[model samples]
Target chain A: MRSSAADRTRPTPLDGLVVLAVLAAAAAIFYFFRPVSGNFLTARIVLDNELVAELPLSDLTEPVTLEVPGVRYPITVEGENGRVRVLHSDCPSQDCVHTGWVSRSGGQIVCLPNRLVITVTGGAAEADAVTG
Target chain B: MTHSVRRLTRCAVLTALALAISVCEGLVPLSVLIPLPGLRLGLANLVTVYALCRLSGRDALGILVSRCLLGAVVGGNLTALAFSLSGGLLALGTMWLLLRVPGLSLFGVCIAGAAAHNTGQILAAMGVLASPAIAIYLAPLLAASVLTGAVTGAASILLVRRVPFDEGKP
Candidate 1:
């Protein structure tokens, strides 16, 4: 009797365990690869390397509307000082806000959907990349 | 001699196809609306997912491993290898598990695999950033995974049915 594809059993517990282990291991490896820190306040709205807006830390108190001629991008800067980033955007990808708060110095916020970027400049906040 | 030669030829062909897709897709610039780094379209995954069920496990692994190594070399960036490795392994493992379920077609299996792969990659990125806050991106990524997975899974199902499946014979 030929076995049909429908007779197959679902993945065993070992399979899930293996996948979890792989993810955890990869996380451990990348944790070591990230940079500690270098610069500060590199925060600027740059598109194609052209500075569109110089977003000062003080301006982050409320949502700012950035007009890109044909399109208007609403960038909301949330969170308090020390940790700051574009918390919201009108773009489709929402990648800008997803970048999270970039205050780690040398960290950057890039919104590919809108061709926008917010780069922060600061030095290392911690010694170890894992802890920081 | 013919059998061994055929196996090698098959692997080389699949590897090249996977690499080509990876590079070609990389050229298409599709950035996120947010500034979160390490996000991508994951187009190469379509090939990897297709190979897992259509071909043997070792063959699929061979294609993925070669694609990653050669892709990094070609792109001149070693950093991407980690993401691909983690995502690929997890995706393959998930597909393997789900593929066993009765009536779970390749489309369903691939969709599950895609979701798991994205989760794995995001987890890695979060670790690198050392910020649990990045977990918020999971929602968007999961959404994208469903869409991409469904498309890729459907394509693979077509390919499987059209292409000859003599090796596994299932």
Candidate 2:
């Protein structure tokens, strides 16, 4: 069998389409599930359904320490004018730190070891804070 | 019976190669490039791609199944089995899909397969944790997937060039 250019290879347009489709689906999922509010100051830390910590992060200057059973993580709040983030953590995975800054609605930092989560709600903090 | 035996032997050799690469990757600490956790070279995927193109789908699946089971035993990380399972299935499935295209090279197919594998693994993590937030990390994982996919795919391409897949009858 004589090998020819056709036998060797060609560009796969369908493969590119597949990659684009997956990317689009991912973006759609992200957009659909995106939090409604755009305010980053409504960040809250919750364990189970009870509110552990709530911050209006517009004036976040101090680092906060959140401790659960067998785990202690310090959430360092930095940045000014509503662009704050959890700078550091003591978790084994360090996933929370890699989560970068949470400025958008529906963004959160979770430490599975302690079953702890820091959520950034897009909406303004209600006068009466509701626990989820 | 002779044909079956030859296929099994080939599968066994490929499995050994995959396992060796996986073990070698595990032994070394590779945090210098980026500090992202659960990062691996996934060199084993070269064998998976080779089997998918040269052998039957069943043969490719067999390689993956055997590799996953024995790989977990040797690596001693049952937790990793979940990620590998999801990733392998997705990777193989994508490769099979691309195989339908008449002129697609094994290298392109493998690259596509690797990307799908990473996506599947990340999705599995999110599902297991009941946290959709993990989706945010997909960008970095996709970037890594492209790089590793190209490296492994190119290597697999060169390998197929050297060892033609037309010899064995499955």
Q: Name the best candidate (by TM-score).
A: 2
Query: How well docked is model 2, in DockQ terms?
Result: 0.15
Question: Ten consecutive residues with minimal summed lDDT in candidate 2 chain B?
Answer: B160-169
Inter-residue clash pairs, candidate 2: A37-A122
Candidate 2 residue lDDT tens string, A19-97? 5655565566556655354444666777665676666654445544333333355445333344446576666787777
Q: Per-residue CA lDDT of candidate 1, range B1-170, in tens?
A: 87677778888998899899878867764454434344455666666655665666777788888988998899887767777777878887877666666555555565577778877777777777666556656655555555566566666656655665477432
**How would you encode candidate 1's per-residue C-alpha lDDT over A25-113 as one tens digit per residue?**
44554454443444323355577667655544432455444443323466565433345567767888777776776665556777776
Off by over 4 Å in 1: A1-132, B30-41, B165-170
TM-score of each: 0.56, 0.68
Instruction: Compose the digit string of candidate 2's lDDT tens values, residues B1-170.
Output: 98878888989998888888778877874545777555556678888777766666788888888888898898788878888889888988887777776556655576677778878888789877766667766655555665666677677766655665556345
